[model samples]
Target: MTVVFAALAVSRHLQDATGVSIQNLVRTLRTVRSATIRLGRHEITLALDIPAAAQAILDRLPPRGH
Candidate 1:
């Protein structure tokens, strides 16, 4: 599935980009289940807020073998 590939790719990117430990990454993800915000007229919901930074890193990643 694409989901599996994305997760694996991000995991590899995280390993290459950050010194943070795998335990720490997993813990962080566990702790941040979701994030939410509200305004008087509108609301914003982020299901993956905890891993947003990691995903951002993935977004900026160059093609592999570059």
Candidate 2:
């Protein structure tokens, strides 16, 4: 969820800067199937399936021109 939120925020920023829609930004990210995060100390590892996460974010966004 946190990753999705961060992605959404970045998409929003890119939209503002590039005149692109959030949907487009997210769609471009669909190629990213997964990501790994490494944490120190505990050596925690987190894997994210980006397509699913992108879809989840897209699901929450209102349709364009709303």
Clashing pairs in 2: none
Q: Pick the candidate with the highest lDDT.
A: 1
lDDT string for model 1 (1-66, tens) is 999999889787676666555565666556556767998988998876546755554455467787
Whole-model alpha-carbon lDDT for candidate 1: 0.66
Candidates in order, TM-scores: namely 0.41, 0.34
> Counting only residues 3 or more apart in sequence or on different chains, how many pairs clash (N, Cα, C under 3 Å) in candidate 2?
0
The window of 10 residues in a row where model 1 has the poorest summed lDDT is 53-62
Output the lDDT of residue 1, model 2.
100
